[model samples]
Target: MCFSASASFVGSAGIALVGVATLMQVRTPRTLLFAAIPILFALHQLLEGIVWLGMDGRLTPPWPQLAGQLYVFYAQGLLPVVMPMAIWLLLPSGERRRIVPFLLLGASLSAYNLWFLATLPTDIGQCGHSITYHNPRTREMLVAIVYVIATCGALLASRRRWLVIMGLANLAGLTVVALFRTWAFTSVWCFYAALISIMVYWHFRRERMARHVEEAPQDHHFPAGNGP
Candidate 1:
């Protein structure tokens, strides 16, 4: 397998594990939304693997082009909006207000990017050890800034320590990719984000266990039919 394929496979496996753990404890709409992130990311990684095979000549003509476009669709068209929206949903109502702007920005950007993707051509190629996805519409600095804010800002604004850590890790990864490997930003950063998603599973599982512990004593003190 190629570097891209290898990386994508590893990422997909990690996210799949997180997805299982997430499913085990999801108890609310917000938790469901949060749980979906790993599955979405796993799909994203799998699509990238297809793109890799396409680029490597392991797949036929139009297939590579199609795979490339699909990869771009997720990286540029869906992720900005999905990331912030998921984070916003996971936050408390009071804290959610602070993330509203990010969610709105992400939605607007995603809409525009999806339109751009539909009308424009996307080019994908291998660069050094990563893949570079080219779409002229997404090259502007303003878009870059807003993309960061929409994706990273929501995570950073979270009251959860784990989410904050994930946000900081992603921010640092994005900064490094932007500065040193701008061409491979999408590929590299997605991998980084997928790795950090493990923290999300940890956060959810820990919270669920803590809640169970808290409820155990209460359940013991107050029998099913007893009331003060």
Candidate 2:
């Protein structure tokens, strides 16, 4: 339940290692963005760790505020867009068209969130064992609905079975967090999303293996003992 600075930092470092390994499995430029998510998630957690330090009274004024802003900027202002875009780009050519609407929707939502987060006031407080971020616009039910369609819907739409599984996992994670800790939704969901990048690692690993099998060199040599 308790998330400390040390714990966040350690988690960040561990995920970063997995993220890098996932990135190494990428076989195409289109997949690079999707593969980079875990790395970005690592940085996101690192920012939260700084926020944790601030909450513990270890950071001076302004620093904590800056960290919190950056954290929210990504969680609220950016993820909806990036998640869909990542999926869109990673999709095979024929399938890319199917995801265009979700990409557009996510981009529009991201723009609204970016504008709101940039202009509005945001505050973070320790709610029980989690950090609760207060952003009025992000709290809107409509916005939450749109955000879900943008992120999870796109993932579910993918032809890739692994992506669909990832989508389901995230949906389950969101429901659990929303049910038990609505106030800490931002913190907990982002953390859960970070862990969900494990699916990304596996997805790419499996895809890479499949690609190798398909592309593996074949022996075209004729038999040495042909009929006279």
Candidate 3:
């Protein structure tokens, strides 16, 4: 189904809310940073939608255009930087060896942004009749591929099986969206907005699972006169 500007905004708002709620599941060192990634991503799409509605096209003019461009660049690039840092902090000291692959993956994706900026024309007319400067669908497909690789690398290294499953599922979904090219809307922005909304829902489900575990009392007995 096609999404109007208001609907897009509402979807982003839900995503942002879910991201924020996910952060509250625990006060881990990585929680805020990791959760913020999705929120920023959701907001990035929301702002792009607002700009599209304002400009009546994808390649809007002036500040909003630049702002959206910058946001996308950072979201695509910096998220990798931050995700590895979060995973590093969460990993056990003995498992520090696992961090190498994640670092390499994140760095490689971050480098793609630099290469894209250097090789691609940032000129206004390069893309037209749409809300993005480049062919957004093409760009998004590439970004999804990079994320698939990076997250897969992380999942493989992660001791947690759930992370592997979730990472694989995310990779599969993004790959489908990229390859099939049959989205609910013609607008690439709308497709991303919808895709990210599904991701936000998945994050919420994870948060609920975390809460359930936290609420459940532990039955293990500690040594007498000693406590955790």
Candidate 4:
């Protein structure tokens, strides 16, 4: 009925869908790790949206007698940064064995987020917009910087041109977020990441197709023994 509720519901649903899609496609550690990023971020945004919708306005500082702020700090501030790091670190070696665990873990975290939102008051400030002492959003932004660094380093190690491009773009976007505190370009980075993911996926698929093509029997019309 409220804007915050609607946004939160939509955001949460979208993230859940992403998690489901990722579950269907995750057949490798890299995909699992990569998919986890969007999945977690989507859920984080959804939860924040939920808080916004439920409250119907900005939450006062030290809400519900300070426990509210603490809750917000952990849920909105910490989990988004933590979950992806966990998935990236603990991801299985191969896709087949990982599907169940990865899906279960990711889904569980998302579900927890959903449940947490459902139970809590919607009155919380956006992470970095706080005017109080217990602000955690700033720390979360710094955490995001760490993510950009690690992701860029990984891209360089892979030596994939598309990855390098995407990695650099993402780093640039995060830098913009850090410095200007605006995210007009961050939306562009999201699209860029999606494109890069598709390109890398298709690139590998094409390589596999080429291998198949090469391995196929050639129809060379050689005169049986004369060729030998």
TM-score of each: 0.89, 0.94, 0.67, 0.47
The list of candidate 3 runs beyond 4 A from truth reads 1-4, 57-60, 118-120, 123-147, 182-228
- Which should have the higher lDDT, number 2 or number 4? 2
lDDT of 4: 0.44
* lDDT tens per residue, model 4, 13-110: 66556555555554555555555554555554444443443344455433333543443444433444343443344334452343344334444444
lDDT to native, each model: 0.81, 0.89, 0.56, 0.44
Runs of candidate 4 exceeding 4 Å displacement: 1-19, 29-31, 57-147, 182-228
RMSD of each: 4.4, 1.9, 6.7, 9.3
Candidate 2, after superposition: displacement of residue 21 in Å?
A: 0.5
Ranking of candidates on TM-score, top first? 2, 1, 3, 4
lDDT of 1 by residue, 1-228 (tens): 127776777878878878788777777888677777777778778888887877767887777678678878888899999988888888878889988888999999999889988998877888887888888988677888899999999888886788888888889988988998887888887777777777777878888998889878553465478566
| Candidate 3 weakest ten by summed lDDT | 123-132
Query: Residue 199, candidate 3: how far off, in angstroms?
Result: 6.4
Best candidate, lDDT-wise? 2
Better of 2 and 3 by lDDT: 2
Candidate 3 local lDDT, 176-225, one digit each (tens): 64565433212453345335444434554676788889999989986688
Of 2 and 4, the candidate ahead on TM-score is: 2
- The clash tally of candidate 3 reads 2
lDDT of 4 at 11: 54
TM-score of 1: 0.89
Per-residue CA lDDT of candidate 2, range 1-228, in tens? 137888889989989998999999987899899999999999999999989989999998788778889999999989998999999889888889878999999999999998988888887889877998988987888988898889898999996789999999999988898788888888999999999988899999998899899999998998689777
lDDT of 1 at 49: 80
TM-score of candidate 3 relative to the true fold: 0.67
Q: How far is candidate 1 from the true structure (C-alpha RMSD, Å)?
A: 4.4
